[model samples]
Target: MRCLYCHAVIHEEMSWSDLLFKRIEDPFCGICKSGLLEIKKENSCSVCSGKMEGSGTCGDCLIWNEHQMYHDVLHSNRSLYEYNQLLKEMIKRFKYNGDYAVAGCFRKKIIEEVKKLPRQTLLVPVPVSEERLQTRGFNQTEALLVMAGLKFECLLTRKNEEVSQAKKLKHDRHSGENPFKAIQQLNGENILLMDDLYTTGTTIRRAAHILKEAGAGEVRSLTIGR
Candidate 1:
């Protein structure tokens, strides 16, 4: 097989285990794989999986929990990698440059995490505004889930067109009106929001807020980057 990111051939020797049972090879080459900075769970905050000094929630999560509008809106969030330079460039290419095949590099990890969630939990891809979707040619979050071969409910819609999150300042990220609105009413079903990145987490919290208002229970999130 070829590396998903760099398109190099992957050469592997057959082992006894490989002959005895079916084994799925990694879709990335060593060089590309090594560049991925995975966030170890042990050193991360309980709420957002962000790096922290101790075994507790991070300052950002605490502030969100304390805020009246976002209090307890999101139960937790987990991310696969750090927003390092390599990842930033990859995201820029995949998201802005319309390199849809880049989504394949993350398919295995995203599928694995989704499988670990409860069977009853609903997978929800955070929505993009119509204008943004048209400009980008696709919703990056939805593309990630689709490339992973996962089923997700399009339960939310964007209420307004807004500036890109990457260009938004921290205060601007948090201060804007919530742009998400639920497209369907949930019957207290548990939801797991899927997104490509989590910065200050204003986007996830805003989406979670709308999910709660639409009768969802125990909203959590899984992101490709933190």
Candidate 2:
């Protein structure tokens, strides 16, 4: 096999488990794999999974928890990887440049995490605006879930085409009118929002607020990056 990211040959020293049982293997070769940094849950914020200097909440989560409106709107978030330079470049190429094959690099991790969520939890992929969907030729968030072979609901819709979340500053992200609207009334169901990135986490928090107001029981998130 070959590295999914760099297309380099992957050499393996087979262990007995490989012959005896079905064991998942790393998709990328050592050099490429080294570039992907996973967040250590023990040293991360309990709410948003941001890296912590100690064993408590990070400053960003602290601010969100303190906000009267935003507090508890998003129950929690679990990010699989840190937004390192290598992942950034891969995301740029996959999301913006239309290199769909790059999605394979993240498939293993996404599948592993989804399997860990409660069986009854509703999986929802954060929707892109119609304009963005047209421009990009695919909703990247939806594509991530689809590529992982996981089922998700289109529960929310982007109300308008405005500035892309990537272009917005922290203040701008917090100031925007709630762009998401629930497609159907939820009945206190546990929800897990799926997205590609979590910066200040303004995006998912807004989505969670809409879902919570519509009666979702617990609104948490699973993001590929933090």
Candidate 3:
């Protein structure tokens, strides 16, 4: 076998516990596995899934819930991993460097998580504009989900002449309206917006706003990193 990220030779072995119980299927080798920063089940904001003090929702979500500019969008969000250095490199290679095969690293795990959600899930991936589509050739978010066998569509389109979320500063993101517009209306259905990363919560909030305004019943987001 081979390690997925580093492409090093993976020596296969099993411990005594594996013989008695279920065998371990470790995708990453020891060094690569050590770099994976999974999100711990800790006290976090119910809305954004961010680590915070106490059991209550974080102040950031509270501000979003109360802020006039937010338009009462963004119900809740969940993420699988933290935005650690290792994850940053993985995302860069997959997204910017055009390594589509890296999607396999999270395919099974993402599918497993999606299964735990409510049935009849409307998996709507955040869309890229024609300009970006032409530049990147493939959408990074869509690439991660191509194997999930779930019904999905690009409901949101990026506005023309808009700077990407990546280029915007933290304060700049919060000040302006999102650059996405809904292409269709959804009526009283559960929506799970899929994206690659969750940063200052601006993009997801903006996307959720349009989804809610378009009549979605409940809008939640799932991201690979937070």
TM-score of each: 0.95, 0.94, 0.87
Q: Which model, 1 or 3, shows the larger lDDT?
A: 1
lDDT of each: 0.90, 0.88, 0.80
Greater-TM-score candidate between 2 and 3: 2
Q: lDDT by residue for model 3 over 1-226, one digit each (tens)?
A: 8777788888976778888895425557789778877765476677777887756678788878788867457767888888899999999998888888777677766876788778787888888778887877898788877845456877888876467778989998888656889888888888888989999898888888888888888888888898
Clashing residue pairs for model 2: none
Q: Give the lDDT ranking, best first.
A: 1, 2, 3
Report the C-alpha displacement of residue 149, candidate 3, in angstroms.
Answer: 4.4
Please provide the root mean square deviation of candidate 2 (C-alpha atoms, Å). 1.5
Which one wins on TM-score?
1
Off by over 4 Å in 1: 16-23
**Cα lDDT, model 3, residue 220:** 83
Candidate 3 TM-score, C-alpha based: 0.87
In model 3, what are the clashing residue pairs, if there are any?
none
Q: Candidate 3 — what's its lDDT?
A: 0.80
Candidate 1 structure lDDT: 0.90
